[model samples]
Target: MAPSPSSAAQHRHHSSLPTVSSAVSWLFLSLLFLYVVYYSTILFEPAPTFTTTTTTKTATDCQDISTIESNTTRVLRFDTELRHIAFGIAASSRLWRIRKEYLKLWWRRGETRGAVWLDKEVTTTENENLPDIHLSEDTSKFSYTNPNGDRSAIRISRVVSETLRLGMEDVRWFVMGDDDTIFIVENLVRILSKYDHNQFYYIGMTSESHFQNMLFSYGMAFGGGGFAISYPLAVELERMQDRCLQRYPGYYGSDDRMHACMAELNVPLTKEPGFHQNDVHGNLLGLLVAHPVTPLVSLHHLDVVDPIFPGMPRVQSIKHLLESAKYDSASIIQQSICYDKKREWSILVSYGFAIQIVRGILSPRELESPARTFLNWHKRLDYTAYAFNTRPVTRNPCQKPFVYYMSSTEYDKTREKIIGIYTLHRERYPYCKWKMESPEDIDTIVVLKKEDSSRWTKAPRKDCCRVLPATKNGTLYLWIGNCQTNEVIEL
Candidate 1:
């Protein structure tokens, strides 16, 4: 126990040499093991797979788990380009002339891909500014028992599988819609970009009417509004959908058929409010004015709804609305509420759509709900038919909104922002009995907004706005954008 200091130091030195030697030996072994692993991988690894959307490769086929895992990483849904999607539009030869006009509105001849599945064949010329046309496979074997439903549902339901069978190269998502469906392609791409193509996602929205959702599963994605299926999901659906269809022969429409098959696969719906089924008919003002704070992806049942801009042809009005979307689809019809403290007035701007000027200041909460300007799909059903919240139109003429539909939108080079100019819709509202000041004399409302797509991927909030009121003639100027820090909307 009482050793000399020199002796104790010598013992410590002896023990440290073995410790150092053992570490060096282990380090050498680790390096050697790593070297072997690296070389073995290089020598035995299978060449990387180059898969087209049609490739039949499976993870089970490969014994090299490391390579399989590495290859699967390439299948994620990020940075998806427009070329990666394929559209399956259900059409009929009888209505081809009219429906093709709708297709021409947004169909990019070379840039967009996929075909229109028609009930019968139609000849196409090189100059046809539309997608290729294909005849749907005869669905005589399928049964539809709904007394009011058409057998065409069977044909339309098969469009997705037939489209997938076409084996489009590099297709990440398969989008399905009706002949009359108007798709905003850029917004569709943006909406799909949020999902993972490697996983199964049935993305779309249900009907605007509660009765439709009640009859059909609330979880169903109405095909008329358009729904997207991931490539993997499409492949899985293609396998069992035909057999699955047999079990649901009584389905009312194509959407329910697809929904039933999706249910069989256990893939729940991924609802995107922007994909509007628009089951209601009549003026679309109330709905578009208070659209959910999301990109305008698609609009359905446009034929039944009145022209978006009063007095203009239905087609022309839609084209007019699209002018603003062309510049900024992400913010199209997005609602922004602002107040005029001086005038004690409330103004709501639905960019690229319409501007609402109320006679008196109204709370933002009340303005957020869409006014019951549109009738329910079934006229017998009252305001309660809407699946979403709605407010009844006021019998008081003073409270009625002085609406101005967007006449045009243009980018101001000097201002560095796109400006939307809305003009008064000439239909005279019930004369106001109240003795308060009104926007009746104001002929124009000009709104300025800078476009940014990234705002959608972040938290969803209504864009903040201020009433500039710097008017020239009868014009009112306002600017809307991301809110400033601690910005509050108040009187």
Candidate 2:
């Protein structure tokens, strides 16, 4: 049958619309493919120039970010001073995703806070290809046969050594950390303030296993898994690179050997609380240096350890935990909502009852049977559960336009209460939605807050029952309800 225009429009609206779910899935697939390709190439490459020579190089060559050098000095300096530093990340083709993920902690587009990322460039040349050699991530045939991770260390060292040679100047200090390691940037600057007392300093987590190298009840950072040094310290460290590499051949899997090189050159090492490569959960607060995330640098054989906030996908989860601790025994700040960890969300259906459910108000009977069935079904049906889940697969949200904008309409001028079961409201409950004409609505229109991760904050201020700006370009679904009548109007 030839459908009516209104019926056809409605059917098209519901059937032909694209969803946020589809976009997110597409992005995840694309990145996964890139990551797979990168790692596969790195696993099976032949050994490089420094690998065959023993005692000529240290095992420090094997670790990623080993190519610390000074060639980037011209490109890094801004405003004629070394205010910003650029990290030249070398993600062996296999581990580029890991590198990308790790680097994201420091850099994200549109965020001009601190530091900048000069777009990543991969090494294309082969092993034994001198300064310009590239590393791949296909670790299918990797081994620990040589205690010194020769080939890997040499590749990483060449890149990092060159980066230091370029990026650093007479700035306060230059930090060298791993992609997996989470650095407390503010704390590092604090430690840098004290560099005058000691110029050529090597800072990192001390190794308890290598306790033989201690001095004055402690030794400086045992390795360079992750650490920092001043400009003079940087220069001094650079001078020892060749001799250190020559003596150890390739310090495969050994980052601290660079520290050992610094120690060999009489560069004094100081043990501070923050500069750590180990999981010091309790000590994170006061420490001057530490890897808050994984790939715990400065210390080897500790990469497999887990972060304190277990299973947390976002940094906010960790911060919330710390905040909960910080206010312990103090005034308790209540979160607006508490979500179930295992199950994503719950729907509570009340059958046309009381307007308010307050401390003394009448309570409505919830549909316990339907709720139970829905939860059980969600648990049992893996595919449906996954589709409904709200966890973000990609870290970069705005980069990939996976999620669509919500439809918004101005509240009726005569209404005493804003009662609507909006899809936006369902996803982001307690979101402040206010009308511009209502003088009393000032409280409802929340001010843009710092660190607020809500998207509704940017919702334009409107007068009449106007549709939100972005919704006009695509499909918009909204569920409006009347509080007094106990009826829902789905649009």
Which candidate has the top score in lDDT?
A: 1
Model 1 residue pairs with clashes: none
User: Residue 323 of candidate 1: its Cα lDDT?
Assistant: 74
Angstrom error at residue 279, model 2:
6.4
Per-residue error (Å), model 1, residue 8: 39
Which candidate ranks first by TM-score, i.e. highest? 1
Q: Model 1, 379-433: lDDT tens per residue?
A: 6549779899999887777877889888888888998899888898777777777
lDDT for 461 (candidate 1): 93
Question: What is the per-residue lDDT of model 2 for residues 274-300, given as tens digits with 9 covering 90 to 100?
Answer: 444442222111111111212122222
lDDT of 1 at 292: 88
Model 1 spans with C-alpha error above 4 angstroms: 1-77, 123-125
Note the Cα lDDT for every prediction shown. 0.85, 0.33
243, model 1: CA deviation in Å?
A: 0.8
* lDDT, model 1, position 246: 88
TM, every model: 0.83, 0.37
